[model samples]
Target chain A: MGAPLTTRGNAPKQDRSRATRRRLLQSAVACLAERGWTGSTVAVVAEHAGVTRGAAQHHFPTREDLFTAAVEYVAEERSAVVRDLPRPAGVREAVEAVVGLYTGELFRAALQLWVAASNEPQLAPRVVALEARIGRETHRMAVRLLDADESAPGVRETVQGLLDMARGLGLANLLTDDGARRERVVAQWAAVVEAALRG
Target chain B: MGAPLTTRGNAPKQDRSRATRRRLLQSAVACLAERGWTGSTVAVVAEHAGVTRGAAQHHFPTREDLFTAAVEYVAEERSAVVRDLPRPAGVREAVEAVVGLYTGELFRAALQLWVAASNEPQLAPRVVALEARIGRETHRMAVRLLDADESAPGVRETVQGLLDMARGLGLANLLTDDGARRERVVAQWAAVVEAALRG
Candidate 1:
């Protein structure tokens, strides 16, 4: 896979510092996805970024610092995708757009980070917070689209349910080799969310 | 709090070996929940179970074996709870029963185990398998309740979606502090499931 912003080798020559920071985060994500959290280290991350360990340290003083940056980067990327959605033509379009964001590559990266974070006591809180932020943002969008209020009975639950289904779908998709099944799951999710909003 | 079956102090007087094994698994779960996957250790688990390091090793020849047994134990406990439900009187009851199991102690323990396993490369495949097995079982139960086959349009998707909602509810409940809020989430889950089944 191409290095994310964290790869120093891919950074512009004019922006050494910014490039180094990006490379570190990108490298951290790669290390986490390929070798898992336990196997990830500053030296490895620096090597992955094609930079010296000192450069990685300059960006992130500790492994935890690097992990936090990586997770934040991933979360921001995911948030950007969701926030960039063009105004939906209608409720149907909103549902489809939400599904698309949740099932996209950015989401896949987030899921990889999420799986790693869940097992990390220090990182779990940050991961949970990140997800909660996303949930609140997405729910706001859903509420806006559905013309529903926060106090409406079952509205929050339905939104949370939809988000959860999307996450579960991503996880299942990652673990399984079935494309047709993944599509079917997404279609089903869209239907369920549509029904909830319609109600 | 407890040792995997091989741990010493918690072993049964009637069957020392069986007791040791039970203690180790319990200890492992408690240690995992408390310290997380990375921070947990065989020595800590042994200490938690009130056993010596030697006893812990005698019972579980390796860390992988110990973790695997713990995974199996937790999975079996969860399966027993869900599988024990008698035929539901109706769709509503099935929905409630399923939702209840998701929010129940068994699922909570399983969730903790799952979070811990997510970080362990060697443990992840086993966790994925266990999760798939549970999902399939849930699907079968839903199929019987819905009176539909896998090929039936929306049947598989609906079943899978409901399971996702239940799981999401469980995690949400775990994260929230308010007891009343937790109850509301459960009610909302039941409501959504009932609505879907009605359609």
Candidate 2:
């Protein structure tokens, strides 16, 4: 469902327009989560938002635009959660923070996006770009927390490896439904990445 | 497209039966790959296979059955490839073998299955179970290659971490199309895992 918008013509209802856009984006997220990428369409998004398809289209002209916006929305939400997180004192804290964030609530929407992108070529590139941004930002966080120089041999790859494990473990936990085991696995992950960086 | 199969009463020929199944499975792969899980129906599978819908239904009684067989077939193919690979002499070789194979061709098919499973609740549990089996098997292989006991302080997590990274990097590469960089990343991954195990 597309969010209701208060356009220039409806100056007094500008807040309504902003509200509509927000509703539409939220509806799109629900639709994507429910239907996967290919199954998600403008019509469905509109229906989900409880708005007319025309209204949905009025808010977002193309499905691609909606999808791109939704991804950005997800990324922004994730970034917001981690933004104020305390900087890790060392490798363990950094690893724990990264793993914890990834394995927690912050990951649900992004995982949906990841699954969607896997099958849709048109969607894959954009999702990949978004992920690349996440990777770069996360690496920066790791560098600050680990006190590693970027130019140091294997520093980037070391951090990348940690991110990779976080993702892998996330998928594994989702698939396996072993919450306790996943926690153990994640803690173990923190240990390995910590060990790797020490050397 | 569904395969052209002979009736149970009388098979067309042994080789022809094999060919029919092969064609049907290939069509299923193509259809699923092109359309995502929801888009790939038995009728579409049949059409893609150049066979009749009736024939497809006759050979595979249910769409779930057909999809399950298709997944198993792909898993078997991957298992075969891994089996045929020469035994690694030590930790480094084993990690390299697993990472290289995973990040290459095997990763694409696996990602498709992962994406497909997300849309099919019926398929998700089974797919998840199969993936867990694979994870455990890979972990076992790592334990053997590294000559580490399960009781070893960090062996299990380290092995799990390596497998996790292999999968994470594999999926990331498939989505991002950063093949060359992924290769380097996997190589670096192997180095890190080897280092962890050694420590």
Candidate 3:
């Protein structure tokens, strides 16, 4: 993975540099989703972004740098999407929305990165830290979206269980067409969560 | 990955051949847990098994074959462990046993394979089929152990959700030391399960 490139001789126009970096990060995510971590090299990302190798290097010097940026970039973009979604009216709707959030392209890209990071020594620490931050943010978002009562006994665990099950479903979907089964799991879990809230 | 080697020339003594195969499978699991898929090459597995390259080759011809066998071997071993574990006296104990079963070395080995199979085209189909089978068996066992009423509304979903959550916890434990948090999730979930049963 590439290290973040330091600003070099005479800062390039800020807007253009930012745009180039954005493009590279987007390209890196695309590569990760389609080809996985090993396949998504700096050169490949640059090519995908239609930028020169030097331009890519100027933005992300190491593969780690590029991957780290991509992971953060995708997480923020997904978080924004979650934040923008209309607040769900009931537990069922909330479950559907939350499950949808987890089953999208963002999840796939993140899964690829997680699998890659799990094996790579150089990338493991960064990925672990990123996942922790993302997991916490995701949990917070879910609690808010569901209007879940944190003060209620077992509420936190209920929320955590929902999030974890969504992740497992996301993983299952990665290998096979698990949409039907995933829907059932979500609905069942929604019922459980509803029961907990009421009790 | 190695393809299963056909019996070539007078089969070496059956006992010795079986022993060699077992050793290789054990070595492959150890390698996967420690070195991951990319690093657990045929040469490395053979070296770790203390078997000559030719002897290892006589059992597994391709890396895929070796990994495939190792996956099955580990799954069978784990299934036996689950089968032999004393049945729980209550839902909480059942949950603890199930959770403990998931958060062990077997889960780690299986996880490495899952991550590898996710990215490797050659291994994906086998892994998918194996996972589906294991999942179904696991679900059945959970229902049995919990004495869950299958005909009850949401019973299937409850079981499925638990399994999915356990898998998620297993995945989380892979990236970080999530033991304390996992215990909380398990305890909370067990309470929910007990409530669902009584309700």
Residue A91 miss distance in model 1 (angstroms): 6.1
lDDT string for model 1 (B84-163, tens) is: 66678766666656565566444554555454454566776776787677667767766665454566567677777766
Comparing 1 and 2 by TM-score, which wins?
2
Number of the top-ranking candidate, with DockQ as the measure: 3
lDDT at residue A193 of model 1 (Cα atoms): 64
Residue B108 error, candidate 1, Å: 6.4
For model 2, what is the error of residue A188's alpha carbon versus the real structure, in angstroms, after optimal superposition?
2.2
Report the C-alpha lDDT of model 1 over A7-99, residue by residue, as the tens digit: 656555647788778888877876775565667788988998999988788778878788767856865765666566666776556655555
The complex in candidate 3 yields a DockQ of 0.51
TM-score of each: 0.73, 0.81, 0.91
* CAPRI quality level assigned to candidate 2 from its DockQ score: acceptable
Residue A104 lDDT in model 1? 47
Error (Å) of candidate 3 at residue B18 is 1.4
| Residue-level lDDT for B114 in candidate 2 | 68
Sort by lDDT, best first: what order? 3, 2, 1
Tell me the tens digit of each residue's lDDT in model 2 across A1-199: 4455645456647787777787888878777755666668999888888888887888888887786687667657666766766777766667767666566433545666776666667777777888778777767766766666668677778777777777777766554565676666667766666666666
Considering only chain B, report the TM-score of each candidate against the true chain B: 0.70, 0.74, 0.87
